[model samples]
Target: MLSEGWAKVYITVEGDSGDIERCCEKKDSHMEDLSLQYVNLEESENLERHRTEGFSSSKALVVRRGAPFRVSLQLEDRTFHPKTDFLRIKVMLGSLYVIIPVTSSKKVSSSSWNAYIDPEGLNLQSPSIFICSPASASVGCYRFQLCVFTQESQKAYAIGKFILLCNPWCREDAVYVPFEDQREEYVQNDSGLLFMGTPMNLVSRPWSFDQYEPGVLEACLNLLQVSPWHQKNTRLDYLNRNNPVYISRVVSAMINSEDDLGVLKGNWSDDFKQGVHPSMWTGSGDILKQWAQSGYSPVKYGQCWVFAAVMCTVMRVLGIPCRVVTNFNSAHDTNANLVIEEYYTETGQKLNVSKDSIWNFHVWVECYMTRRDLGPGMDGWQVLDPTPQERSGGEFCCGPAPVKAIKDRRIDLLYDIPFVYAEVNADVLSVIVSKGRVISYSKDTEKVGSLILTKAIGFPIHQSITGDYKHIKSPTSSLTSRRSTMSGDSTLSRAGSSNGVSVSLTLDRAQVAGEPVCFTVKVINRQNVAKKMKVHFNAQAKEYNHGPSDAFWETHGVIKLAPMEAKVVHQQILPAEYAHVLGDNLINLAVVVEDMDSQERVLASEEFNIASPHLTVQVADSIVPNKVQTASVSFTNPFSHPVSGVLTVAGAGLIQGKVNFRVLSLCPGGRMEQHITFVPSMVGTKMLQASLSLTNISSTIRGFKMVSVHGA
Candidate 1:
């Protein structure tokens, strides 16, 4: 298909070798120059291809082995469809000579083919020849045939050739050109269109790895060809927004209405429903399934995105424009309050969930709903989540009434009132009401009606009321021995007179038979006068039926002060059992007036232990040989408190063995030391626990290390 007049060839010797003579011939328009360097195998026995001019370079063959060797080929680029009609390469060096004939078609695209030299046969004096290209091929890319021969062989020793021809299935877009291009043109070719929608916050150089691979490109082309979307009048924009939801809902509704949609529709297979579930969007899979069976699912239905997507699909089907946005915010919305306790009771599990902890992830969705839901003049811009029935549902809507919304409603009242006390059939006051009107009211004026209140009610009442007016004086009713009101005094309980109602309490854990428990007491003012408030504290003895005579505890101290002026009463419980360690065991403490008129009065409890933690060392195990195979040490905890101690091993190769510890510290540089450490002597695994005699000691502890060795 091509003439020799339009072809040219060039070649040069390559590698560490002498040149082999073989002049290139140029017939008319075809110039075969055999002078340029040709790439030869750097190492013998290896194969390599050589290129010259163009002509889709050809592989080299060792015609004659010498210092320098090269390849020869014919090149042609006249017009686009050009080909070589015939090619032959001859080699001669010293007494060596050979010839090769080539035949080719035009379909092969690569520029070169490999020619190998046999390591055993090729030598400095051996002669070889190779013939390639210029074959009876059509106008297309092709490989040339290569033929090898030697001076002694009459018929061609080896013959090979290749050719390429045009194919209708070739991809024009996938073509690559390595030769000619301007710098500006090259720059413009590399830049692709940038995505403009959405926030392009991150910018970086384009990546080639993400480019469609050969297989992917072929698949895409096949898909496009099958659908013929360009010729079909299909609404792609509407399809993009509505297709997924239509499929999702169809799948969901089918699943919900039938026990087995696959059975109803025989065409459906089990594999198609592998990952599908009734709870489509619930983050927690198990919880959703459980709730789903209950007829009213919580978590699954609460997934705002799922509902948002479904709703968006519905809206689009109805010709409405909308978009979905997802984000996380605190429960309190703006202030980010981190200390609100929310207990979920629907799941029948009572857990005090706190907003302060790290689990405080509040997720919600936003959608463009009707604007009238927001406010006036903003009727069509209401952004909210469709799943409003969820736990933390809907977008944060700070409407016009924000001033009246209190985020922290739990602590609105300083104290909670579990119960309140009131006067009933007491020699007290009475109030009469008629037709929702207070007809009459009266009291014992001087004394308040008998009121029995528990701590729950007393605390809140104390925090609510400071200066009192009349305990039971009323403006209307005549004196009576009973009281009448809308809410009867049925909730009240009789607590006897305030006098002689003495309650002596102590920290049970801090007190033992022979130990002293430190505690404080405050006496508030119930009367107006600066009366001397007599205070007394005594440790009552244990009642024993067969013991000697009963002894009454003597009052340790007393405080006298004016009315309304509170005094701190410090006391302790002293039993005879701890007499040996009473001096150290006595929890010494003094009551300080930390709060004056403060409703919140906190008492401090101090702890005193009689024993201190100390470390004692003992060689746990010894082996038969003086040089032990693996030695181990154990530490025991024997103190009333926790202590931190360091154990160190000084012998060499100490760090080479397997070392483990629970209480000992492991140091570097073979300085085998640990708050705990383990050294294995035998060739077996030993389960060992290292515990230190920990004590809350203020200073460095003294000796007390107990060790016990057990066989592994």
Candidate 2:
């Protein structure tokens, strides 16, 4: 039972009179001044022996709402005994506060603090306490004051002011059921995903969200447009506010392009023309902190991988279960026609007419939730894409598309299952056009969405679930009958070949900025007599949309091949030759072979990208909020001529304003370094993203450094 002195302090204030009375009472109390210390339970086994001051002066103690918290405290004055002394905790938020009387035993009461005080310690004057936040406690930051009152002294002393932040997680949110062995992995561990390059069977790189980092929950609340500390609305507002629709709407809007703070733009050429690697990113918390600190500006440049990774972080921080999945050979079926068409000229030069395109790989996030909105079997995993490519309900976002609906080809379902269905199952048509007429074309069903993958829970291995979505047979309805027939027949009849002569082309590897582009063309002659053929080769650089930009090199030659002979024609392009024509590091190369006597032609073409050097920024591993820090930006020229550019450095809490540096003449292969200094305004994970844009080259290279900041 609480003593009378502590009981008199537990008053429930409601109106203006209560506020006036509490203020007058605080001023009248002649309490002794004593320093309060917090015990470091994580670092020390004995709570009484290891203790530090509780305040912003040290790292904040973070815990989720409803989670048990243990804190051992010691008073500066050894005259106070824990057994006889009464302690009261006051939690203050703005003008309102809650008073809970600390007790030696756990007692059930609305105002009673259910805590256990251990008096038997190395220092008998110090006491270790166990406290638990009520399940209904709102998520936010609060200032708490602990005071001790002695019956002999008949006075209460103010010990210290501590900051307590309630995270967004509750027991109801921990409903994610993983496999028996993976139960601990999904709930307590972080997942991983690979990015940047072509999809491979390699293990995904590990990433930690570190949701416990200070200000993470607040930043997440900001993303959801919820006030962290103040509660104008109750938990029951809008079906508990944590419902699927509310969560989806918040996440969708936060990641979509309509809001720049969404962090990613689907347009690849705008920012990635110079070269940005998604794999280089550290983790989601780093990206989010950087965005939050930058005042919600889109983080320089990001593609599908970056969007998915950051979305995963936001969802996990909000107590939602999330995982990043990658689809290899993903099809962007812009028209919802269930077919992506590619056009090529007679000489195999790819035409830029078709809006459809196939990405080497595309990544997106899957969130686990029970969808009462859709009802029934749709209550499992829902797909959500942060990349703003398609518009959903006039907004640039996609999903909460139910995975079950996508697998069953239920395109009529809510959200954007149709778009996702095309991404994983669309047939790719390769068409050859000459003189405004279609000459030859072939459709390949297996090319797009070859393998759908996600990391195995608790394991560093690739898990293939391609068969799950691919098991459904082609739709036989009248609407899709013609298109389905075209796909089946096109596979049986290979286009671009006639008279038993076949031509094939292959690139040595993806071209780099300073390296030569080399490819081989193979032609088989099945005729009994010698044959004369004309070979036409062409190379051009084009934008990601397949729009032709410049024709770099073209040549024609005649070759005589004997009967039953197979000839391989090799072409090598020097760096100096294509450097001036390649605008965005992407090139479309084509090769064609013609049998002059029969007027038959065979064509082959390929598209590849060249890599550019990245602008690197280096800063300290850990930064202190409100303290000045210096960062260095390094850039290397990978071109033949001198490049002039502007380097811009910006961050949210790390810098006050954007910092810029101008380079007049950075010679090719020359390295340049610049330094910038700024003070951080808030504590948590911070990002310093820098970009260098060439004035003459129309290109931009970007890089970022993520650092943790301790509260001052």
- Worst ten in a row by lDDT for model 1: 196-205
Instruction: Give candidate 2's error at residue 410 in angstroms.
Output: 6.4
Q: Which one is best on TM-score?
A: 2
What tens digits encode model 2's per-residue C-alpha lDDT throughout 36-142? 43332331222111111111123333444344456656445553455455666556544445666676665433222355565345354456666655543533345
How well is each residue in 1-712 modelled by candidate 1, as lDDT tens digits?
Answer: 3332122323323222222223122235533321211222222221212211111222322211111222332212221111332334443321223333332332322222223332333332221223222211111111222222122111111122221211111122111112223111111111111110001010111111110111211221122122222124224421321222222222222211122211011111213253332212211212222323333223222222333333332222211222222221112311232222222111111122332211111111112222222233322211233332212212211111111111112222111100001111112222223344432322322122122111111111101010111133344231221122201221121111122111122232323322344444545444445444333332212100011112233343334446555444555545433333321122212121112232111111111233222233344454222233433443333323333543333221122222323444322211222343334332211122222222232222222221222344
Compared with the true structure, all predictions reach lDDT values of 0.24, 0.60
What are the TM-scores, per candidate, against the unseen true structure? 0.17, 0.62
Clashing pairs counted in every model: 82, 2
Q: Candidate 1: how many backbone clashes?
A: 82
